[model samples]
Target: MIRGRHQEPAGERESGLADEAEGFLLAHAHRDQARREAEELCAGMPWLTTAQAEELTGHYVRRRLDVTRDLLLTTALRAGQLRQEYEARYAGLRRALLKRHAAGVCAVLVCVGGASALACLLAR
Candidate 1:
């Protein structure tokens, strides 16, 4: 029998699937928007022949998609960098909190011990 095989929990699996679906939908929407924008842009120029307008629209959509792809890639990279930075900051803050707590505990213990010793000596 395999021991300690790691498996994604059902909730996480479902969430992953949902995220994938959402990403797909978002990409579709972006493509549609880009196409619409291209059409709108070509519409502004009434002199273009039907074939030229279509060609220009196609070119515009392609360029928009390329720009969008590049922007998304850059944003993803920056998000990853930000995540790493935030994690590091969180870890540093956690360590500092723990050290402060330990120091507090030690200070309390020292004060209590000193007071107890003084009381005993005075009573003797």
Candidate 2:
């Protein structure tokens, strides 16, 4: 029960984990896109129009800055941290999905082998 409401029973745990993992991957990708888009919007703004940049920052950013370089460095670090977290979460979910699927497949193969052996003994 790593999460609630979406958690699956042992029988189908792999598929459920896969689904959840895939969802987060897609969401993370979208988050990455949004981040890039935001940066592009800032870069594309006219430097002559400091008002537009200020206006954009007013709405889209909230970092306090006594100096431009410090603010830029801090914000960049924050973004990097966010990216790392997104990638880490995605990897974690992917691993969970794979582990669950492997367990499930093993269980199924065991059941199938047991049934086949029983059938052969019955026929002989």
Candidate 3:
């Protein structure tokens, strides 16, 4: 039977010894479960103490928090990088096209001015 595979949020409760995994954790685990698991693991071993159990429990909680923080930091970093890339692309498109529009307008104005000047000379 499986004992240690990660369970999904919805179906974790049902993945038991049937999975053929070793060292598998229970789904919907809690702090009390942690203490119970610690108790079970240390039942036959002589090296651990009450203080050690508390320390181990605290360590587990801290490690979970650390992993969560790392995931959030990674997601934030990726989002920031994507935002910067999009902004850069938009800025480049704006820069490339803006001057062309202005140049077209200026060219039209110059053509009209030259036509007016020619008409005035012809009338002279």
Candidate 4:
């Protein structure tokens, strides 16, 4: 996360807080899982000294965290790219739809005005 001080509106601040909380929870869960896996691996190798097992578990957790971080970063980058692409497509489609609607409205108005003029001429 980029660290900078900027005042946000209440709604946005709340959203940011929620996002932070969610991230914290997810990080904790990942750490817990990694530790559990490390402990299990250490458990299986009963011949290792206490210091060695601790070192191995620490290394394993660090590696797991690094891999997870990299994967999350990649996913976030792809998601951002996808969001931009979809937004651009949506904007283009919206413009086209608006143009078609305006044309249809103009056509309807012209038809109505012509019929009104014809009726007025017939009445005279």
User: Please, what is the TM-score per model?
Assistant: 0.86, 0.44, 0.47, 0.87
RMSD of 4: 3.8
RMSD of 3: 13.5
TM-score of 4: 0.87
Worst 10 residues of 2 by lDDT: 60-69
Tens digits of lDDT, candidate 4, 72-119: 999999999999999999999999999999999999999999999999
Model 4: clashing residue pairs? Answer: none
Worst lDDT window (10 residues) for model 1? 1-10
User: Of 1 and 2, which scores higher on lDDT?
Assistant: 1
lDDT, candidate 1, 1-124, per-residue tens: 2588878889998999999999999888988998899889888999999999999988988898899999999999999999999999999999999999999999999999999999999999
The lDDT of each candidate is 0.94, 0.73, 0.71, 0.97
Better of 2 and 4 by lDDT: 4
Q: Which candidate number has the best TM-score?
A: 4
Ranking by TM-score: 4, 1, 3, 2
lDDT of 1 at 115: 100
Q: Model 2 over residues 1-124: C-alpha lDDT tens digits?
A: 4655675578698887888999688656654555565567878765636677656655443332223347657999999999999999999999999999999999999999999999999999
Clashing pairs in 2: none
